[model samples]
Target: MSLALKNEQYANELWRYKNTAGPQRQYFRMGLAAVLWRFLALHEGCVAAHCAVPGFGVVTTVPSTSGRDDHPLRTMVADMVGATRDRHRDLLTPAPNATSLGRTASPSRYTSSALWGENVLLIDDTWTTGHHAQSATAALKASGAGSVAVVVLGRHLNTTYGDTATHVEQARLRRFSWDACALRPWSHG
Candidate 1:
C-alpha cells in the first residue's frame, strides 16, 4: 500500500501539507480492498458499496495486483460480497462530483433499494475530509439500509507540508522496525 502512495521525490511544499481532501486516500482504499474483506469477515450478511465520482482520473479501480493479475477495486469488492454468497448484495453508487476530487454531490440523487434489504459496508479508498463518507451514509440511509459502517485502509492525518495539525494535535503516529539482512557480513552467534 505504501508503495502505491509513495512518490520517488516529495516536494517541500507537498510535504508540509496534510491532504484531508480525500482523493489519495480513496486510492489507498482501492489498494487495500483484499485485506479489508478478510478483516471485516464480509462474506454473506452485508453488501459492499463503492463511491463513483465522474472525473477523478484514477488509473486503476481494482485494489490488488497480485499473481500477475490486477483486480479492479470493483472486482475485489464484488469478490468480497460473493464470498458471502446469498449473504448480501453489492451496490455501486455513482455520484458525479462536480469536478474530479470535488465534494460529493447532493444525496438527493441517490436511492437505497440497491442495498435496502440488508446492512451495508461503505468502502472507499480514504477518509480525510470525510465529506464523501458522510454524503454516502446519508444517501444509504435515505435508501433504507438497516445500518452502515465504513472501512478504509488509511486515515488522513492532516500532515500537510507546513502544518502538522492532525499528527500533533490529534496524536496520530506510526512506528516502524527493521531486522538486519540475513545476507549481512556478520558471523552467526
Candidate 2:
C-alpha cells in the first residue's frame, strides 16, 4: 500500500531534496516522513484488517546501494517517533559484489542475515523501476523473513519518459477513491 503517487512538485521534490546535502535537508526529509506518519495515523485500523497475518513484526527500508552505511531513507524511518520506530530494523544491504542491478529485478542485488520468520513491512521512498525494492524483498525471503509487504511512499511517474505519459493520461481519466485492498505477500505460502 502506497501513501500517494509522486511526480514533479507533488511528493517528488520533497524526496529529491531530502537526499541532497544542505541545512534544509532535514526539513525536506521530515516532510516526507510526515506523509508516512499521517498514513498510519489515518488508516490505523486497515493495515492488517483482512490480511492473514496479525500485523507486521518488523519494518525495514531498502538499503541505498550508494555505499552509505545508513541511507537517509533508512535514517528517516529510524528517527520516526511513531509506533513504527520500534519495529524498524536495518535488515537488508546490497549483495557483496553484485552486478547489473540497475532497472532489472535481480535477487542478487541484496543480502540479509537469517531471520526467524519475522513478518516484514518493507518501505521505500519511491518506486522507479522497483528493482531495488523487489530485490530487497527477495533477499529478505531467502534469509527466512516472513510475509513481506511493500509500501512505497510514492510511485514515480515521468510524463515525458517512455510509455509513462500514456499511462498517466489513462490514469487521469479515472476518479480517485479511498477504497483500499490488502495484498498479502504470503497468500500462497
Candidate 3:
C-alpha cells in the first residue's frame, strides 16, 4: 500500500545520522499503526494457510542495503502494538553477491529464510524508486511465499525532482485524512 508521503515540509526529521530515531518518530509510528490496522482489517479474511500466524504470516522490514546492522526501523516495528508486533520477524538478509545493485530491481538483492509458502506483508520505511521494495518482493516470492504485499511507509516525494513538484502542488488541494487512503486502489481510479 503506497499510501503515505515523507515530504520535507511535513515528514522531516526522519532518522538522520545526528538525529537518530528523529524527534517525530512517535508520530511516524502512530501513523503507521493506523495504516497497519486498516491494511490487516481489509485483508483479514483473505489470508491463506501457512501464512505464519493469525494472518499476514509475518511483517518483515527490508534489510538496510547500506549494511547498517540492527536498523532502527526494525526496532520500531518490533515495538508496534497488536498484530504488527506479534507477527514481526527478521526474515531477509543481504545476499552474498548484492554489491552494485543500485536503483534497479533484482531478485538476488536479498536472501530469505524458507518461507514455505507464507503470505508476507513486506514493510519498507521509505520508497525512493521502489527498486529495493520490488526486489524484496521478488526475493520473497522466490523463497516460496504465497502472496506478497509491499507496504511503503514513506512514498518519498522529492519536490525538485521531475514531476514530483507538480505532484505535490496537485496534492496540496486535497486535505490529508486518515479515514481516506492517500493512494486509491486501481478499482477506485
Candidate 4:
C-alpha cells in the first residue's frame, strides 16, 4: 500500500513543489523524504517484513520521461532505505520517444537491462494510471529480475463529483487547504 493520498493537502502541496523548477524544489524534495522517513518509522513492522525477504538486492525507481539523469525520489528513497544509489542506477530507462499518456493507456515506453536475478524495490513518486510502474515492472521481469515490488508516495484520486442527481461531470479539481498533515509546515496564507 502507498504511504499517502495525493488528494490530501500536504501531499498535494509537495506535488506542486515537485513540479516547480527552481531551488525551492530541492527543499520540497527534502521535505518529502522526511515525510516518507516518518511514515516508514511509524510502520517499522512493514519495513522489517519487507527487509526480511531474501535476495532483496536494491532499490530503483521508475524512469521519468523528462530525460533527467536521476530522479530525486530515487535518490531520497535509496538514502532512507540504506541502499546504494549507484548500484541500481541505469537499470530502467525511458524510451526516447515516450509521450505522456494519461491513465488507462499502458504504453511500452520503458527498457531494462542487467537486472538478471536481482530483486528490486521499485519506487515512484505518485501512483496515477500506474502505466509507468507496470511498464517498468514488466520490463524488469522480462529482463530476468528475480522480483519487483512497487511503492509510491501517493495514490492519485479522482475528486470530481456529479452536479445533478443523475449526471456526473468529470471536471478538474484542486485543493488549496494546507491543514491536512501536521508535519507540513507551509501553508497558503
Tens-place lDDT digits, model 4, residues 76-134:
77664433344455578777766655443343677787666777777777776788898
Candidate 2 stretches greater than 4 Å from native: 1-7, 169-189
lDDT of 2 by residue, 16-91 (tens): 6455677567767777778677665544335555445788888889887776666777877777637578888888
Query: How high a TM-score does candidate 1 get?
Result: 0.47
Local distance difference test, each candidate:
0.40, 0.72, 0.68, 0.62
lDDT of 4 at 70: 59
Across 1-189, the per-residue lDDT of candidate 3 in tens digits comes to: 342345453245344421335555566556656655665554443333233344577778898878688765676667754657888889889886675877899999998888887878888777778898899999888989878877665677666677877887887786654434433322211
Pull out the clashing pairs in model 2: none
- Candidate number of the best TM-score: 2
Superposed Cα RMSD, model 2 = 4.9
Q: Give per-residue lDDT, candidate 4, residue 16.
A: 61
Model 1 scores what on Cα lDDT?
0.40
On residues 36-91, what C-alpha lDDT tens digit does candidate 1 reach at each position? 44544532122232322211111112121122232334444555333323333434
Q: lDDT: which candidate is best? A: 2
Those runs of model 1 whose alpha carbons end farther than 4 Å from true positions after fitting are 1-31, 42-71, 80-88, 95-101, 114-117, 161-189
Error of model 4, residue 145, in angstroms? 0.4
